[model samples]
Target: MSKIDPELKKKLLKESQAPFKGLRKIVWIAFSGSAFLGLFIMLAKIASGNELQLNNLLIQLCACIVFPTLLFVDRNKD
Candidate 1:
Protein backbone atom coordinates (compact mmCIF):
# COMPACT_ATOMS: atom_id res chain seq x y z
CA MET A 1 0.00 0.00 0.00
CA SER A 2 1.14 3.56 -0.75
CA LYS A 3 1.49 6.21 1.98
CA ILE A 4 -1.23 8.89 1.92
CA ASP A 5 -0.22 12.57 2.06
CA PRO A 6 -1.22 14.51 5.22
CA GLU A 7 -3.12 17.28 3.34
CA LEU A 8 -5.02 14.78 1.27
CA LYS A 9 -6.04 12.86 4.40
CA LYS A 10 -7.36 16.05 6.03
CA LYS A 11 -9.35 16.95 2.93
CA LEU A 12 -10.89 13.52 2.78
CA LEU A 13 -11.81 13.66 6.47
CA LYS A 14 -13.58 17.00 6.03
CA GLU A 15 -15.49 15.76 3.01
CA SER A 16 -16.57 12.60 4.79
CA GLN A 17 -17.93 14.53 7.78
CA ALA A 18 -19.81 17.09 5.68
CA PRO A 19 -22.71 14.84 4.75
CA PHE A 20 -23.47 13.98 8.37
CA LYS A 21 -23.93 17.58 9.60
CA GLY A 22 -27.62 17.68 8.64
CA LEU A 23 -28.29 14.00 9.17
CA ARG A 24 -29.48 14.35 12.77
CA LYS A 25 -32.04 16.99 11.83
CA ILE A 26 -33.24 14.87 8.93
CA VAL A 27 -33.68 11.80 11.12
CA TRP A 28 -35.66 13.75 13.72
CA ILE A 29 -37.94 15.20 11.06
CA ALA A 30 -38.66 11.81 9.56
CA PHE A 31 -39.45 10.24 12.93
CA SER A 32 -41.68 13.16 13.96
CA GLY A 33 -43.58 13.08 10.69
CA SER A 34 -44.25 9.39 11.07
CA ALA A 35 -45.49 9.85 14.63
CA PHE A 36 -47.76 12.70 13.52
CA LEU A 37 -49.25 10.57 10.78
CA GLY A 38 -49.93 7.77 13.23
CA LEU A 39 -51.61 10.15 15.65
CA PHE A 40 -53.74 11.61 12.88
CA ILE A 41 -55.03 8.21 11.89
CA MET A 42 -55.99 7.37 15.46
CA LEU A 43 -57.68 10.74 15.96
CA ALA A 44 -59.63 10.42 12.74
CA LYS A 45 -60.98 7.08 13.78
CA ILE A 46 -62.10 8.54 17.11
CA ALA A 47 -63.69 11.57 15.44
CA SER A 48 -65.72 9.25 13.24
CA GLY A 49 -67.00 7.43 16.40
CA ASN A 50 -65.28 4.17 15.66
CA GLU A 51 -64.03 2.04 18.55
CA LEU A 52 -60.24 2.03 18.87
CA GLN A 53 -59.27 -1.33 17.53
CA LEU A 54 -56.22 -3.13 18.84
CA ASN A 55 -55.20 -4.37 15.40
CA ASN A 56 -55.27 -0.89 13.90
CA LEU A 57 -53.22 0.54 16.72
CA LEU A 58 -50.81 -2.36 16.50
CA ILE A 59 -50.27 -1.73 12.84
CA GLN A 60 -49.50 1.92 13.46
CA LEU A 61 -47.07 1.02 16.26
CA CYS A 62 -45.38 -1.48 14.01
CA ALA A 63 -44.99 1.15 11.33
CA CYS A 64 -43.42 3.59 13.75
CA ILE A 65 -40.98 0.99 15.05
CA VAL A 66 -40.15 -0.52 11.67
CA PHE A 67 -39.33 2.74 9.92
CA PRO A 68 -36.72 3.88 12.43
CA THR A 69 -35.32 0.41 12.74
CA LEU A 70 -34.79 0.30 9.01
CA LEU A 71 -33.15 3.72 9.02
CA PHE A 72 -30.75 2.69 11.81
CA VAL A 73 -29.85 -0.57 10.15
CA ASP A 74 -29.16 1.12 6.84
CA ARG A 75 -27.02 3.86 8.36
CA ASN A 76 -24.91 1.37 10.32
CA LYS A 77 -24.27 -0.69 7.21
CA ASP A 78 -22.27 2.22 5.82
Candidate 2:
Protein backbone atom coordinates (compact mmCIF):
# COMPACT_ATOMS: atom_id res chain seq x y z
CA MET A 1 0.00 0.00 0.00
CA SER A 2 1.11 3.53 -0.75
CA LYS A 3 0.41 6.73 1.18
CA ILE A 4 0.17 10.24 -0.23
CA ASP A 5 2.43 12.95 1.21
CA PRO A 6 0.65 15.69 3.19
CA GLU A 7 1.97 18.44 0.96
CA LEU A 8 0.92 16.65 -2.19
CA LYS A 9 -2.52 15.96 -0.74
CA LYS A 10 -2.95 19.60 0.21
CA LYS A 11 -1.93 20.76 -3.27
CA LEU A 12 -4.27 18.33 -4.96
CA LEU A 13 -7.16 19.30 -2.72
CA LYS A 14 -6.66 23.00 -3.36
CA GLU A 15 -6.34 22.50 -7.10
CA SER A 16 -9.41 20.32 -7.28
CA GLN A 17 -11.59 22.77 -5.34
CA ALA A 18 -11.37 25.50 -7.95
CA PRO A 19 -10.19 23.79 -11.12
CA PHE A 20 -12.23 26.20 -13.22
CA LYS A 21 -11.41 29.37 -11.36
CA GLY A 22 -9.75 30.98 -14.38
CA LEU A 23 -12.51 29.95 -16.70
CA ARG A 24 -15.10 31.20 -14.25
CA LYS A 25 -13.40 34.58 -14.07
CA ILE A 26 -13.27 34.82 -17.85
CA VAL A 27 -16.94 34.03 -18.17
CA TRP A 28 -17.78 36.47 -15.39
CA ILE A 29 -15.87 39.22 -17.18
CA ALA A 30 -17.59 38.54 -20.48
CA PHE A 31 -21.06 38.50 -19.01
CA SER A 32 -20.45 41.58 -16.88
CA GLY A 33 -19.06 43.48 -19.85
CA SER A 34 -22.06 42.64 -21.99
CA ALA A 35 -24.41 43.65 -19.20
CA PHE A 36 -22.73 47.04 -18.86
CA LEU A 37 -22.77 47.48 -22.63
CA GLY A 38 -26.46 46.71 -22.80
CA LEU A 39 -27.16 49.20 -20.02
CA PHE A 40 -25.19 51.85 -21.89
CA ILE A 41 -27.10 51.22 -25.08
CA MET A 42 -30.37 51.49 -23.25
CA LEU A 43 -29.30 54.78 -21.75
CA ALA A 44 -28.31 56.04 -25.20
CA LYS A 45 -31.71 55.18 -26.55
CA ILE A 46 -33.31 57.12 -23.75
CA ALA A 47 -31.07 60.07 -24.41
CA SER A 48 -31.97 60.05 -28.09
CA GLY A 49 -35.68 60.15 -27.26
CA ASN A 50 -36.37 56.70 -28.62
CA GLU A 51 -39.37 54.84 -27.31
CA LEU A 52 -38.58 53.00 -24.11
CA GLN A 53 -38.80 49.24 -24.13
CA LEU A 54 -39.61 48.44 -20.54
CA ASN A 55 -38.83 44.77 -20.77
CA ASN A 56 -35.48 45.30 -22.43
CA LEU A 57 -34.56 48.00 -19.96
CA LEU A 58 -35.46 45.78 -17.02
CA ILE A 59 -33.50 42.89 -18.40
CA GLN A 60 -30.43 45.01 -18.91
CA LEU A 61 -30.71 46.56 -15.48
CA CYS A 62 -31.04 43.19 -13.83
CA ALA A 63 -28.09 41.82 -15.75
CA CYS A 64 -25.98 44.83 -14.86
CA ILE A 65 -26.82 44.47 -11.18
CA VAL A 66 -27.06 40.71 -10.82
CA PHE A 67 -23.84 39.58 -12.48
CA PRO A 68 -21.60 41.65 -10.27
CA THR A 69 -23.56 40.66 -7.22
CA LEU A 70 -23.12 37.03 -8.16
CA LEU A 71 -19.40 37.52 -8.68
CA PHE A 72 -19.12 39.15 -5.29
CA VAL A 73 -20.90 36.26 -3.67
CA ASP A 74 -18.77 33.71 -5.49
CA ARG A 75 -15.59 35.43 -4.37
CA ASN A 76 -16.68 35.48 -0.77
CA LYS A 77 -17.27 31.76 -0.88
CA ASP A 78 -13.54 31.14 -1.24
Candidate 3:
Protein backbone atom coordinates (compact mmCIF):
# COMPACT_ATOMS: atom_id res chain seq x y z
CA MET A 1 0.00 0.00 0.00
CA SER A 2 1.11 3.58 -0.68
CA LYS A 3 2.10 5.48 2.45
CA ILE A 4 -0.14 8.40 3.50
CA ASP A 5 1.46 11.78 4.15
CA PRO A 6 1.85 12.66 7.88
CA GLU A 7 0.15 16.05 7.49
CA LEU A 8 -2.84 14.58 5.68
CA LYS A 9 -3.17 11.82 8.27
CA LYS A 10 -3.15 14.31 11.13
CA LYS A 11 -5.85 16.42 9.53
CA LEU A 12 -8.04 13.38 8.96
CA LEU A 13 -7.59 12.24 12.56
CA LYS A 14 -8.50 15.64 13.92
CA GLU A 15 -11.77 15.68 11.97
CA SER A 16 -12.65 12.10 12.87
CA GLN A 17 -12.23 12.76 16.59
CA ALA A 18 -14.37 15.92 16.68
CA PRO A 19 -16.88 15.29 19.48
CA PHE A 20 -19.57 17.66 18.24
CA LYS A 21 -18.97 17.19 14.52
CA GLY A 22 -22.53 15.95 13.88
CA LEU A 23 -24.36 17.85 16.62
CA ARG A 24 -26.18 20.14 14.21
CA LYS A 25 -27.33 17.17 12.20
CA ILE A 26 -28.60 15.37 15.30
CA VAL A 27 -30.45 18.44 16.51
CA TRP A 28 -32.02 19.00 13.13
CA ILE A 29 -33.24 15.44 12.98
CA ALA A 30 -34.65 15.67 16.48
CA PHE A 31 -36.54 18.84 15.67
CA SER A 32 -38.03 17.55 12.46
CA GLY A 33 -38.93 14.21 13.99
CA SER A 34 -40.68 15.85 16.90
CA ALA A 35 -42.56 18.18 14.61
CA PHE A 36 -43.68 15.38 12.34
CA LEU A 37 -44.83 13.24 15.25
CA GLY A 38 -46.73 16.14 16.72
CA LEU A 39 -48.41 16.89 13.44
CA PHE A 40 -49.34 13.28 12.99
CA ILE A 41 -50.97 13.20 16.39
CA MET A 42 -52.86 16.39 15.68
CA LEU A 43 -54.08 15.11 12.35
CA ALA A 44 -55.17 11.85 13.87
CA LYS A 45 -57.20 13.70 16.43
CA ILE A 46 -58.78 15.85 13.75
CA ALA A 47 -59.66 12.82 11.71
CA SER A 48 -61.34 11.31 14.73
CA GLY A 49 -63.35 14.53 15.16
CA ASN A 50 -62.20 15.12 18.73
CA GLU A 51 -61.75 18.67 19.88
CA LEU A 52 -58.06 19.58 20.20
CA GLN A 53 -57.15 18.90 23.79
CA LEU A 54 -54.58 20.61 25.98
CA ASN A 55 -53.00 17.24 26.57
CA ASN A 56 -52.26 16.85 22.87
CA LEU A 57 -50.55 20.21 22.69
CA LEU A 58 -48.61 19.49 25.83
CA ILE A 59 -47.39 16.19 24.47
CA GLN A 60 -46.09 17.81 21.32
CA LEU A 61 -44.46 20.67 23.19
CA CYS A 62 -42.74 18.30 25.56
CA ALA A 63 -41.45 16.15 22.71
CA CYS A 64 -40.00 19.11 20.84
CA ILE A 65 -38.22 20.37 23.97
CA VAL A 66 -37.30 17.15 25.72
CA PHE A 67 -35.71 15.33 22.80
CA PRO A 68 -33.22 18.09 21.98
CA THR A 69 -32.33 18.54 25.61
CA LEU A 70 -31.77 14.81 26.00
CA LEU A 71 -29.62 14.75 22.88
CA PHE A 72 -27.43 17.60 24.14
CA VAL A 73 -27.04 15.94 27.51
CA ASP A 74 -26.14 12.60 25.96
CA ARG A 75 -23.59 14.15 23.62
CA ASN A 76 -21.96 16.12 26.43
CA LYS A 77 -21.65 13.02 28.57
CA ASP A 78 -19.28 11.48 26.06
Candidate 4:
Protein backbone atom coordinates (compact mmCIF):
# COMPACT_ATOMS: atom_id res chain seq x y z
CA MET A 1 0.00 0.00 0.00
CA SER A 2 2.99 2.30 -0.12
CA LYS A 3 2.52 5.35 -2.31
CA ILE A 4 6.14 6.01 -3.15
CA ASP A 5 7.47 5.41 -6.62
CA PRO A 6 10.52 3.15 -6.45
CA GLU A 7 12.56 5.12 -8.98
CA LEU A 8 11.79 8.43 -7.30
CA LYS A 9 12.58 6.88 -3.91
CA LYS A 10 16.02 5.84 -5.14
CA LYS A 11 16.75 9.31 -6.44
CA LEU A 12 15.49 10.84 -3.22
CA LEU A 13 17.57 8.56 -1.02
CA LYS A 14 20.67 9.53 -3.03
CA GLU A 15 19.88 13.22 -2.66
CA SER A 16 19.80 15.37 0.44
CA GLN A 17 16.62 15.06 2.58
CA ALA A 18 14.70 13.34 -0.14
CA PRO A 19 12.19 12.19 2.51
CA PHE A 20 11.74 15.78 3.83
CA LYS A 21 11.59 14.77 7.53
CA GLY A 22 13.91 17.67 8.31
CA LEU A 23 11.51 20.26 6.98
CA ARG A 24 8.93 19.55 9.69
CA LYS A 25 11.51 19.89 12.45
CA ILE A 26 12.91 23.11 11.03
CA VAL A 27 9.48 24.65 10.60
CA TRP A 28 8.47 23.67 14.13
CA ILE A 29 11.56 25.23 15.65
CA ALA A 30 11.29 28.43 13.64
CA PHE A 31 7.64 28.92 14.45
CA SER A 32 7.99 28.07 18.13
CA GLY A 33 10.97 30.38 18.54
CA SER A 34 9.13 33.21 16.88
CA ALA A 35 6.19 32.66 19.19
CA PHE A 36 8.45 32.84 22.23
CA LEU A 37 10.05 36.05 21.03
CA GLY A 38 6.69 37.63 20.38
CA LEU A 39 5.45 36.61 23.83
CA PHE A 40 8.53 38.13 25.46
CA ILE A 41 8.15 41.39 23.60
CA MET A 42 4.47 41.57 24.45
CA LEU A 43 5.25 41.01 28.12
CA ALA A 44 7.90 43.73 28.01
CA LYS A 45 5.37 46.17 26.61
CA ILE A 46 2.90 45.24 29.31
CA ALA A 47 5.51 45.62 32.03
CA SER A 48 6.43 49.11 30.80
CA GLY A 49 2.88 50.09 29.85
CA ASN A 50 4.10 51.13 26.44
CA GLU A 51 1.75 52.29 23.72
CA LEU A 52 0.27 49.47 21.69
CA GLN A 53 1.74 48.77 18.25
CA LEU A 54 -0.40 47.36 15.47
CA ASN A 55 2.53 45.49 13.92
CA ASN A 56 3.24 43.78 17.20
CA LEU A 57 -0.32 42.58 17.31
CA LEU A 58 0.08 41.15 13.84
CA ILE A 59 3.24 39.32 14.85
CA GLN A 60 1.54 37.77 17.85
CA LEU A 61 -1.32 36.68 15.66
CA CYS A 62 1.05 34.97 13.26
CA ALA A 63 2.98 33.26 16.04
CA CYS A 64 -0.13 32.02 17.80
CA ILE A 65 -1.58 30.53 14.65
CA VAL A 66 1.62 29.17 13.18
CA PHE A 67 3.01 27.58 16.33
CA PRO A 68 -0.12 25.68 17.29
CA THR A 69 -0.86 24.62 13.74
CA LEU A 70 2.67 23.41 13.24
CA LEU A 71 2.51 21.45 16.48
CA PHE A 72 -0.57 19.50 15.50
CA VAL A 73 0.01 19.22 11.79
CA ASP A 74 3.62 18.12 11.91
CA ARG A 75 3.43 15.62 14.75
CA ASN A 76 3.03 12.71 12.35
CA LYS A 77 5.64 13.65 9.76
CA ASP A 78 8.43 11.77 11.44
Top lDDT hit: 2
| Candidate lDDT (C-alpha), each | 0.73, 0.84, 0.73, 0.76
**Candidate 3 off by > 4 Å:** 1-19, 53-78
TM-score of each: 0.42, 0.78, 0.43, 0.55
Off by over 4 Å in 2: 1-8, 76-78
Instruction: Give the per-residue lDDT of model 4 (tens digit) for 44-74.
Output: 8878988777787787878878887877775
Q: What is the lDDT of candidate 3?
A: 0.73
Ranking by lDDT: 2, 4, 3, 1
TM match of model 3 to true structure:
0.43
Error of 1 at 75 (Å): 0.8
The superposed Cα distance between candidate 4 and the true structure at residue 48, in angstroms, equals 0.8
Clashes of each: 0, 0, 0, 0
Best by TM-score: 2
Per-residue lDDT of 18-52 in model 3, one digit per residue for the tens?
Answer: 65657755876778597768778787888999889
Clashing pairs in 1: none
